[model samples]
Target: MKYIVKLNFEVDGSVDKPDVIGAIFGQTENLFGQEFDLRELQDKGRLGRIIVDIKNKGGKIEGYIEIPSNLDRVETVLIASMVESVEKVGPYNAKFELKEIEDVRAEKLKKIIDRAKEILTTWTKEKNLDIKEVINEISGAVKTGEIIEFGPERLPAGPDVYSDPNLIIVEGRADIINLLRYGYKNTVAVEGASGKIPHSVVELSKSKKTVIAFLDGDHGGDMILKDLINANVKIDFVARAPVGREVEELTGKEIAKSLSNMVPFSQYLKKQQESTISVQPRVESVITEAKEQQAVQVIEQPRKEIEIKIPSTVMEEIKKLPGTLEGIIFDETWNPVERVQVRDIISKLETITNGNASFIIFDGVITQRLLELAASKNVKLVVGVRIGGINKKPENVKILTLADVIGP
Candidate 1:
């Protein structure tokens, strides 16, 4: 069912202020335990009219929004509550009324998504050419004959091997095999491009700063290539097998060479400056260059002034530590900045390994973003001799908070 709710207000006194109207709505949202998204209500709140239709009772609310035409009863209550709360805000009396529309054809949510994915898959299959090429690549990558599984907790191993992003996509165990072959071991694969991209993939992708699409070359590969592009993923790059090759089909050395060549989204864009490709790297050259450049530039040391007033005993303890966390990343002049821009460096993890990364033993507070970045990069652990809670361990990601990565 579709519904339109109209809010008409009359102030009790001679006062006309647009900000007041907005204030009323804002207060109403807070008072009623409602979330207000202005874009959702923009027409009514700003242009002052709205038609809302919802499959479920509640989403969130903004100060403004464009609502669909129909809604379930629960949603109607939420909308109604908005008007009641606003009425109190203006010191003005407000009235809200709803209108409904019945039975119209809208694509099933799943159907729209599937179609979008299908259309976008065109880009992923071909690094720069035909869809047939992508399908062939996928079928070839799948030939290695190993099974890979993905579920809530016991996820697949190795690199993420899907063309589409906005989801943690993967291909087959063999694809995983090739990635592992290159020491590119922290990835997840869906086994084949046949299944729906899972919810877990969606969750993981949404939680990241960047997504690197790694797929083998083939026709099925092309299909998914298009699917990901069509799905409107904010993908960073598409890394693919080289011409006339599949990851599993390649020798370990060849795979290693290919892995070394993966590219970034920015690089991919440079390659397909004109094509409709979803843009992963060409793999062999791109991945290798990408990783190597990353490793060398991981921590930039420069000097910055920070007041370090420590108890004499604690100050002496620092001198006894090995590979102490006191290294610095620079601020352009090659001088040390007080703290490692840990968040800045950590955020670069397009994809991270599970448990093998160098640890950071620092002194002082670890910001939340830095902790998140560390966890994303799978940097082993964060050990601080000084007191800090900046990086709280989130449930989806993990980090060991220690006085020392080993122990005090």
Candidate 2:
């Protein structure tokens, strides 16, 4: 059962409904302790939303308030009395008069009676549907049933992944489901941004007639593709989800459109390199200026270097790494913690909190975004293949390049 407390109030000067409601809560907070606190009552579903209707006239305000309460009569009456005792709304003096307490159960019963007939009529009509609905349901079940776990990783794949000569590699399990819905029976998912590409996927790619890496149209997708390349997976063609879209969310027509526009992997990489080279000079200038400023600051106050010796074996391993866009995080003891594609480095840093990682070494350009993330995680040093332009240098985090540390 619910009770509606009808209230009438007048403010000396104009005030809004929020001001009046806030005054009620603030004035009555400590009057009855935790049990009867307005916020607690509302949170426990003992109080319904407060409704206020106010009008301004000649710089004064008048309003009618409605508060529905599920509390017992005695408790609700106590609450009403508390609201009536509110002395002000904002800076304006106010007077609240409790007009009446109304039992709302009767009104709710009437509403339920009125709605029952309409609902019954709609339900009767819907009970008589055509066989088309059943057929569609069966068809959907069949399509979803065609999905299978392809390999040891239990990655989502279409039933024909092993049988089909060509393969489509997509970003995740959802992408596989979406492709299966569109009758593409040779699709498989890479799962997630795992440091190593799934061994099953790599072996399968090598066996297919042509492996198409179908990726989302986002930085994360680009990073996954880079990881695939760095893992030496044989990818022939690359298809991208439409700009600002994801594979799982695309319509059937969109999926077809993107597949039709697939480009050779080599051509795609060349285009990306050209774009990076075009911006290189300006980025280099910014880096040089930032380095010069850093040098000035260092000369002003000489600081001791906290060096962690790198083993020659590890240096050789880093040199043998395949791609230019990879990274590894090291603990304070010079032990490797995590390896990630460069584009995903920022995301990796954000997941691990301060004191977990001390050093980061990557074969990619380091930018200001990377520096800020490293600084937040209290990383001591970042060594990249090249350092990109940064407007401001973060204190306490040292940025260097492989050339600066291990020499070219």
Candidate 3:
């Protein structure tokens, strides 16, 4: 037998050993009110339970249960009520029922769980589930903390990038960084060669505003473009770096000139189909300019490779990470785009945004301050390469993927 009993108690400080044990027994004793002596039950161990925490924050009580795997259903529920009462605060309460099915013949257990779920749903509807989380509060300040208000599954930062009347799709986070470094801003990534093109992209392109699929020149990149085209992605062009070079490898000038000459997908496909058309060499001056524009590639020596200041925004993002911001990038069309380096990000900032303006980025974790600042600055998109969420993405703002700003 498992008593599906719960222990809920609000504590001033974070939960400690004493509070845990006390809540368990207090709830258990209340459940058995007169059936057995509290001391006797503890001694016998027949009606005993143990504290198993569910959630905790800054010593304040979060979630936990006492399993009376030794008690019956009625006792468990009675114990649960005591827990709920203990965990209650300002009319808000904590809840989850005790449940046990030793042999799996648990029709009764299922019904109990179902009802408990129903109750929980109702309770959530009536209250702010995140009353504990507020601006500048402990929960909000815990960077990389295991937050439970839900994460990426529920929201992807602020605004969806593809919803813009005109949008660019890149491969992955590195791509986002590069573009962010230069300043294209309205973009998102597919993260890899997978996933249905997001509905936001489909709808925007359907209205005829043009979706540009900026991808790598590799086989995987070609495959992704083909997939999007085949799936009827309403894309207008395919922008790519020179063969064997990704956007990440381009110089600031290379990045600017590429955008300056983006060809529509229709024209690209047409050019590919024309066998009679020869590669027309532009005037010699053009060729010379291209060569001149080729960014100087520096090889590392024993001395530190040109130390440059990472954008304050990028620095802040890295500092707040739970782990390294290392990952492959993909385009919005779901293709392997490129690999990014932490060093490149730092270099790109100094190389591109040099003498431009104050280079700072918003984390986009909350609304108001950052959102207002972005709006006032005419910032159309906020590219968060590491964090993919914002408290809100206001109407004037378009949140982009890391890759969209960098590239595959």
Give the runs in model 3 whose Cα sits over 4 Å from its true position. 1-164, 275-408
* lDDT computed for candidate 2: 0.78
What stretches of model 1 exceed 4 Å from their correct place?
1-149, 153-155, 159-169, 232-234, 266-270, 273-408
Say which candidate scores most in TM-score.
2
TM-score of each: 0.28, 0.36, 0.31
lDDT of 1 by residue, 261-292 (tens): 76775666676655644345332234354355
Candidate 2: which pairs clash?
A: none
Candidate 2 scores a C-alpha RMSD against the true structure in Å of 16.2
lDDT of 2 by residue, 1-408 (tens): 489999999999988888989999999998988999999999999999999999998999998999999999999999999999999999989999999999888788888988998898999897876464445334543565677897898887999898888899986655765677567889987876444698898899888469999987754465577668767889999999876466765667788899999999888777767877422343344346656876876774356455556777678767743233457898877788899855567888889868889989886656677888888888998887544435567767877777676774
- Candidate number achieving the greatest lDDT relative to the actual structure: 2
lDDT of each: 0.44, 0.78, 0.47
Q: Candidate 1: deviation at residue 358, Å?
A: 52
How high is the lDDT of residue 266 in model 3?
71
Tens-digit lDDT string for candidate 3 (198-270): 4544454576566778776543355456556655778876787655445544555676666667797778777
TM-score of 1: 0.28
Task: Give the candidates in order of lDDT, highest first.
Answer: 2, 3, 1
Question: Who is ahead in TM-score, 1 or 3?
Answer: 3
